[model samples]
Structures are given as structure tokens and as C-alpha cells.
Target: MSRILIVDDEPHLRLLYETELRRAGFETMTASNAVQGLEFVETMEPDLVILDIRMAGMDGIEAMQHIMERDQRVPVILNTAFSSYKDNYLTWAADAYLTKSSDVTELVETVKQVLEKQATAHG
Candidate 1:
């Protein structure tokens, strides 16, 4: 099973993503802020990271940079409430970019697709 690190400031989102991803058969871990997420990236070495664009401190863009610096191979999915960040060049660094929604089906599908694509590339 692939391990996914979910980084978001919202508690509900963390729980929701964790629950749904677990149901989908992926192992999951969550960080409430970018700083902790970066730490987890280094220590836990998750196969993929689902990062939020905006947080109280150290936004996802900056955190993604740090994560890439540590290990470029790990895939990152930028999950944000704001669609405007999609136009930003920094977000392009992520393997996938998804806008938040009430329904999480898209998010789950994207995670599966990204991980599958990564497996193909590395395998």
C-alpha cells in the first residue's frame, strides 16, 4: 500500500481525506501545517503528498519547494479551495492540482491516478 501525507490546516479536511483515502486502501498520514508537513516529508518519506495552498504559516508553495529539495521523486498534489492558484507558476511543480469541493470523489480519483502514474514511471 502507498503512504500518502495530507497537509491541510483544516481539521475536518484532514479527517475527511484520511477516512476516504483509507477506505480506498491507501495508508494515510496528516499534518495540520506546512511546517509539520515538511518535517513529515523528510522523516516519514511518504509516497505522495496532498498539500493545501494556503495555511496560517509557510504556505504550500514554499513547503513544496522544500519537499522537492529534500526529495524530488515524491509526488505532490496541490489541493486548495482557491482556483486562482492554478494560474500561479509555482503550483506547476506539483504532480497534480485540484480545487476543493464539497464532494471528494475528484480528490480521491486524482490521488489514485497520480500514484498509478508514478508507479508506472518508477516501475
Candidate 2:
């Protein structure tokens, strides 16, 4: 099973993602903020990370820089509600970018597809 790290400021968002990803057959870990997310990644070394860009402390972009430094192969999916910042967000390196309102089916399919691509590239 593929392991995934989900990071969001909202506890409910993490819970929703955890449940949905679990149903999709992925082992999931949840973190309420980027700091915890980074620590979890250090220990678990998940195959992918789904992150929210508007965190309070260390935002997703900053945290992602650290994550990439440690594990460049670990794909990241950046989700943001602010559509206006799309250009700014794209400057950050991410394997994928998803809007927070994206359909659940699309989210699931995208994650799976990214995981498959990551597997192939690393294999």
C-alpha cells in the first residue's frame, strides 16, 4: 500500500482526507500544520504529501522546500482555496496542484495517477 502524508490547518480537512484516502486504499497520516507534517515525514517517509498552502506558521511553500531537500522523489500535491494566487503557487515545485473545491473523484484519480508516475520514475 502507498503511504501518504496529509497536512492542513483544519482538523476536519485532515480527517476528511484521511478517510477518503483510506477508502482509496492508501495508508494515510495526518498533521495539523507544516511543522508536524515535516516531523511526520522524517519518521514515516511517506510516498506523497498532500498540503494546504495557507498554513498559519510555516506555510506549505516553505515547508515543501524542506521536504524536497530531504526527499525530492516524494511527490507533493498543493491544494489552495485562493485561485488568484495560482501563478504565485506554481513557482513552487510541486508534482501536482489541485484546487480545494476539486471533485473528490478527480482528487482520488489524480493522486493515484501521480503515485503511479512516481513509482515508475523511482523504480
Q: What are the models' TM-scores?
A: 0.96, 0.92
Misplaced by over 4 Å in model 1 are none
Question: Which prediction has the highest TM-score against the true structure?
Answer: 1
lDDT of each: 0.93, 0.85
Candidate 2 root-mean-square deviation in Å = 1.5
lDDT tens string, model 1, 23-59?
9899999999999998898899899999999999999
State the local distance difference test value for candidate 2.
0.85
Tens-place lDDT per residue, model 2, 1-123, is 999999999888788888888999999998999999999988889989998989999998888888888835578888877765578854358888888863567677889999989888879
